[model samples]
Target: MKASVTDKLKILADAAKYDVSCASSGSKRNNKNKGLGNATGMGICHSYTEDGRCVSLLKILLTNHCIYDCAYCVSRKSNDIKRVAFTVEEVVDLTINFYRRNYIEGLFLSSGIFKNADYTNERLIRIAKKLRNEHNFNGYIHLKIIPGASPEVMREAGVYADRLSVNLEIPSERSLQKIAPEKDHKSVYTPMNWLKEQIAENREDSRKFRKTPMFAPGGQSTQMVVGATPETDHHILNLSASLYKEQLLKRVYYSGYIPISEDERLPALKQAPLIRENRLYQADWLYRFYGFEVNEIIDETQPNLDLEIDPKLGYALRHLDQFPVDVNRAPYEMILRVPGIGVKTAQLIVKSRKYGRVRYEDIKKMGAAMNRAKYFIEISGRPLPAASAVPERIRHEIIYPAKKAQLTLF
Candidate 1:
């Protein structure tokens, strides 16, 4: 007898738990054609792990079999692990059932290369097409773009998927070769470049048609496994910056490396760098909404992010030339540059400033974390006395005990 759908669900869902690119924000579901599902602007409510972290979607792998032995991957061909692959029907049924139960808002599908890259990508697209065209499912769908997949298949996948991702697992090309000899940077980036161009052209066509067939409205994103390769956070962020600026990605996920397989080819990190990953995410936020460039957050000397201070704080410390920003007088963008301030706090500054000049006390009342913000920001022409009086001393006092050399995001 064949494995039941429940068995497939356990295997595929377990395999997919490690993937973190399932945010459902980029596309809206159109159920005009009696479609079975739809992507709303509000996206879907998050699903959480047993530990209480958000799981969001019913993430799953179509197959665990692999032809390549990537050093860091547990599913490497050489590893002695139970393997499985789902037929297209199995995946489609699983997604619809999960969605009906409210178990997940959608599906995020990926696979280990089966037979060849295009073949794997073709299967992925078939699953989406079956859902969209046959099943008339309108729920959010995210598909992994297999490296070296043909542009035609990539386009098809784009039309079916709300979001697409191609993971750049390591920061540097040299490390990619070292860890996964069968793969190269070119293979990884080829589909990515194609997706970017397709999205641009599709959007332009939408301008003319008012509604060109939806093609990855949520946009494309990629991931990098931190700490597995020699490339520093600076290198990682620079690459991310390029991907965001050039490729126009919606997000870049930073994964901390967990040594799941024994390969001398990989590094010997004691544990995954979750804190470092958190800091990098914070830095990524700065790059997107805070008007920060790669040069501003990292450079040759500071290749790695400061594990103690978050990226916002670290950037403020290094560039005191721009500090003591007046929250009341400075623009909302400048307020976002402060060490401890986030997008929420920055918005509050804008709101309060319009009514009347905001005082230092008004900032605290507006929900600013004043202790950290005070060091890097001023209000109504008065710099925080302690931050200005002893900036470096205060910086060290705040961050010294918290620094860690190794960072990861597992």
Candidate 2:
């Protein structure tokens, strides 16, 4: 007997859990002329489920019948899982009905290759197109770009998709070859480069003419799976930095490798590397927003992150010479380098400085993480934490405050 739509949804939804690149920020599609929904500039008001999947969007896979037998994938051709696919109209109905019930604010659709790249990509596009033209659904729609799909098809995709992504599952090409032999990095980069140019061109056209259609205003993003290969955090972060600078990507998602099979080629992990995944994100944030270089967070000397503490704290410990920054007198750039001061806290400190010299008590009021920052920041009249203190002692006090060795660093 053929599977019902509910059965297909259960299987495909489970398969889509591996993808963590579905965020609704940076899109501004409004519900004009009796449209069903809207995607705002402030982003969709969404929250995560207990397992970390973005529940605000109806995240699902159109199908899990893949042509490639990648070693790490759950839906690979060699897997003996029950497979099913949703028809284009069935997907449209689901989106429309689900929206009516307020179960989702938008749609995040991905699919495994069926027959070939173009065939699968076209089906994905058709779902988006129908949602826009037939049902007048104007909510956010994020579509995954099938690697090696023609530019012509991708152009149409940009028209309907608020954001597009291509998952670069492995950080290095050599690792990609060993794990997913049938795939190549070129297939992924080609589509990403093309989207970059087209989004740029579309912006220029829109500037010249107001009636020009939108082409992925939210921009492109990609994912790189961690712990699946031997590539260190250095290699992973360097690849991410290059993507942000060169490709002009909106985001680089880091998904921990979830061991799906006992294949000899893959690691036998009892759980996903969630901690390492979080550390990479923290490191990524430091590079993007905190004015730190990739090498500063992790370098040739220490390739992997210190899983015990965050990247910012690790940096402060490594370079003790820069610590105990004077909050009242230090430059805003230097203030950001302090481990306990966040971007917002740094800004607050700077803004308060214009009125008067920022004090230790005022910083506490701003919610600065003084436990860690106390050792790293110096306020006027308030004596500096003992700069002569050993780095190991500071690290121990920060990591384990209960053991509170009478620290030389206040």
Candidate 3:
């Protein structure tokens, strides 16, 4: 029996929830000359703005049928799930209709490998091509590149899509082999490398030729599943560091592993490691924006992130000797290492201190979370009291400050 479009949407959209790499940032496609839509602004998904307004996206899978039996995947061939695939026209129609109604700001399309990588990738490319050439969709489009797909197909995909991603589901090559024997790091990295080259060539061409077409203008990103195997946070962050340095990846998403099946090979988790997942994101932010190295966040001795507090605070607590950083005198790098000071705050401190000393009140106005920053930064060369520098005491105060009052009353 043929399913209605709504039914297919329900199935496919639900199937896509596990994929957390759908944040639409960095694309600047404007709707010029009366095109249907524009992506000149920040790409929207289920992400929020600083003002706390939520923007939505038409995030869904092209299909939920797979040929590989990856133990961690819900749509694995061995899993008994309802199977459905959207025709090219169906996806195009849905995207156009949804956009016209303002139901979504963009489209994020991924798929389970139906027959083979090439076949599935071709279908994805066709969807983007039809939307751009035939329908004149000037809106944002993020396509998930199929692993092991040909470079030719990938090149074509780049010509239409604003962003492309390939999920490296598992972190380590050995663990990936154990769960998904059909996939390897090469199959994932090869297409990523090809996309990197294509984006670079496109940029170079646009420099020389005024009207060169953009190839994945939003840049490429990838994801890795956390807690599925015995790999440590150190391993995951190291891989992310390498990707950022070598592949020049735009984002590396860490999705906490969700147990979809009762496979003996997979972990028997009662719930997803949401705290760890959030910590990984915080650590990733430190790496990207705060100028932190992977070793600074985690080491061989501390293999995992401290889930109670964020990575920056954890680092400050670990190395008490580094604080309290004098906001008016410290280098930008050292100011960034302070517990409560973010990149923006650190920048404000550096900019404002050029005139005179930056007081605590001034720092607070600059957006420093002073509750945490007060303990890690100095005011007019006055450091935090020596007693507050103890790592264990600081940890206790930061994690359970309310308890301190209760203990004092007792």
Q: For candidate 2, lDDT tens digit of each residue in 48-84?
A: 7787666767788999999998888899898999989
lDDT of 3 by residue, 1-410 (tens): 99999999999988887777656668888786787988865655555545343456677889999999899988888889899989999999999998998777778899999879989988888998999998889888889998898988888888888889988899999999999989999999999998888888888999999999788999999999998999999989999999999898999988889888898889899998989999999999999988888898999899999989999999888888888888888899999998888888889889998998788789999998877887888877787563385788878887897898799898
Error of 3 at 261 (Å): 1.0
Off by over 4 Å in 2: 381-383, 386-388, 405-410
- TM-score for candidate 1: 0.93
Candidate 1 lDDT, 150-243, residue by residue in tens: 8988888988899998888878888898888888889878888888899999989999997588889889999888888878887888899999
Listed in order, each prediction's TM-score against the native is 0.93, 0.95, 0.95
Evaluation by lDDT, superior candidate among 1 and 3: 3
Instruction: Return the number of clashes found in candidate 2.
Output: 1
- Highest-scoring model, TM-score: 2
Give candidate 2's error at residue 77 in angstroms.
0.1
Distance from true position, residue 119, model 1, in Å? 1.1
User: What residue runs in model 3 are displaced by over 4 Å at the alpha carbon?
Assistant: 45-55
